[model samples]
Target: MKQYTLLLAEDEPFLGKVVKESLEKKGYAVMLAPDGKQAWQLYTSFEFDMCILDVMMPYKDGFTLAAQIRQANPKIPLMFLTAKADIRDVTQGYASGGNDYLKKPFSLDELFLRVAELLKRASPENQPADEFTIGSYSFSPKRQELKDSDGTIVKLSHKESQLLVLLLQNKNLVMDRKATLLKLWGDDNFFNTRNMDVYITRLRKKLHKDPAIEIVNIRGFGYKLIC
Candidate 1:
C-alpha cells in the first residue's frame, strides 16, 4: 500500500494525538501541527495529499489557513474538523475551499468514510479535464479553480469542481439531476438532493463575478450552464 501524507492541524493536544494515531494506524503519514500558523508553515515546507484542520487555533484560524492553503494548491483535499455547527460557519468552510466539514464529537469511522470519499472523488486520474476554459474564467480541473482575467482565482471544493466540469461538458444542455447525484454522491436521497441545491447556489455565487456565466436551473429535472 502506498503511503499518503496528511497534514493534521489541531490545538487540542489529546484529540490531535488520538486522531493522528488513528490515522497512522490506517497507513497515513500524518504531520501534526499544533496551531494554524505552524500548520501553514508546515504546509509550505512539505507536500501533503490531504489536510484536516481544526476551526479554532492560535496565531491563525482554520478558515484563514484553509484559504491560504487553497491559494497555494486548490486540488489538495481539505476537511475542517470543528465544534462550530452554525450554518454560517459551514457556509464559510465551503467558501474558504473545503471539500468536507465534520463537526466535533464525530465518530472516527465517519471521518474515515468522508476522507475516503473526498480522496476518491478528487483523484487526478478520475478528473475530467486537467484544464479548460469557461466564459471569462480559466478552469483547471486539476487545481479545482476558476482563474479570471484579473488573476483572481476562485478555489472550489471537490464537489463544486466536479459539478463545474459536468456543467461545462454539457453547456446549454440539460444535465440530469439524478444522474449527477448518482455520479458524484452515489445517491439521490432527499438530504443529498437539498445539499446539491446549496452547492449549486454557491457555485453560482462563485462564478457571479463573470457576468456572462450562469448556472440556470432546468425546471424540476436538471440544470444548464448558460454562457
Candidate 2:
C-alpha cells in the first residue's frame, strides 16, 4: 500500500504518541509536532497529504495555524482533534478551513475511519471538474481558469479556485461541513468557520450572474453545488 503522509499536531505528549503509533500501524507515514509552531514549520517545509491538529497548544493556537496553512495551500486536508464542544467552537472550526472536527476522547476506530474517509474523498483522481460547465461559466482544472460563455475570463484566488473546484466536483451532493473545512482550512475552529462562510458568500455572488448555478446551504450540514 502507498504510504500516505500525515502531519499530527498535538501538545499532549502521551496522546500524540498514541495517535502517531496508531496511524503508523495503519500504514500511514506520520510526522508528529508537539505544538502549533512546530506544526506550521513542518507543514511549510515538507509535503503531507493531510493535517490533524489539536486546538489548544503552546505558541500559536490551532485556528491560527490552520488559517496560515489555508493561505498557503487550500486543498490540503485538515482535521481538528480538540476537547471543545461548544457550538461556537464547532462553527469556528468549520469556518477556519477545517474539513472535519473530531472531538477529543474519541474512539481510535472512529479516528481511523475519519482519516480514511477524508483521504478517499480528497484523492486527486476523484476531484470534480476534471472540467466543469456552469451555464456561461466554464472551468478546466487542468488549466485552472474560469471563462464565461463569451470567453471572458474571471480570475480566481487559489482558495477560491479550490473551493469552486470542490463544489463542482461534488455537484448536487451535500458537501459535509466538516469535510469541506478539513479539506481546505486544516482545522475546524470558530474563526475559520466564519472565514468559510465569507468564502461561501463570495462564491455565491460570483456565480450569481449565471442563473443555472447555485450554492445551496444544507442547514446544519454543508453546501450543495447545483448547475
Candidate 3:
C-alpha cells in the first residue's frame, strides 16, 4: 500500500490531534501545523499528496495560505475545515483554490470520506510542473535549486526560495512589498523588511549571470521579476 502524506493545518489543538491520529491510523503520514505560518514553512520544505486547512488560523488565514499554495502547486488537493456557516465563506474557499469545504462539528467518519474522495479524483498526470523556467535558468522551488544554462546550480534558503516563487508568480508585475512581508515573515516590521531586502539582493546576485533576469524594486510598491 502506498502511504500518502497529508499536511493538516489546524489551529485547534484537540481537533488537530484527533484528526492527525485518525489519519495516521488509516496508514497515512500526516504533518500537523499549529498555525498558518508554520504550515507554509512545512509546505515549502516538504511535498504532500493533499492539504487540510482550517479557515481562521493565526498569522495567515486558510484562504491566503491556500492561494499561496495554489500558486506554488496548482493540482494539489485542498480541503478547508471551517466553523463559519456563511455562504460567502464557502464561496471564498473555492475561490482560494479549495477543492472541498467541510463544515465544522462534523464527524471524523465524514472527514475521512471526503479526504478519500478528493485523493481519488487527483491525477498524477495533471500534477504541477516539477520545474519552472526563468530566462536562462531552470528552477525547482521544491528542491530549492536554481540552475543556469551553464549548469551552475545555486542553492536557495527557505526565505530566498519563497520570495523567489512570489516574484515569479507575479512576473512582470509588481509584487506588493507589504503583502510579501506579511506572507513570508508574518509581519511587515522594520526588521523583517530589512531582511527581505537582503534576500532580494541575494537573489539578484545569484541570477546575475543572465542579464535578462532581473528582480527590480518598484519604489514604494514592491518587487517585480522581469525575464
Q: Which stretches of candidate 1 lie over 4 Å from their true place?
A: 129-227
The sequence of per-residue lDDT tens digits that candidate 3 reaches over residues 107-186 is 98978877886786586643335788999999898899999998999999967987888788789999999878645553
lDDT head-to-head 1 vs 2, winner = 1
Over 4 Å off, model 2 = 130-227
Model 3 earns a TM-score of 0.55
Residue 89 C-alpha lDDT in model 2: 83
Q: List the residue pairs that clash in candidate 1.
A: none
The global C-alpha lDDT for each of the candidates, from Candidate 1 onward, is: 0.87, 0.85, 0.88
Q: What C-alpha RMSD separates each model from the true structure?
A: 7.7, 5.5, 12.8
Give the candidates in order of TM-score, highest first: 1, 2, 3
Best candidate, lDDT = 3
On TM-score, the leading prediction is 1
Model 2 lDDT per residue over 29-120, tens place: 99999999999999989999999999998998998888889889888888999999786887687778888888889999989988998888
TM for candidate 2 is 0.62
Candidate 2 vs candidate 3: the lDDT winner is 3
Candidate 3: RMSD to truth: 12.8
- My TM-score estimates for the predictions, one after another, are 0.64, 0.62, 0.55
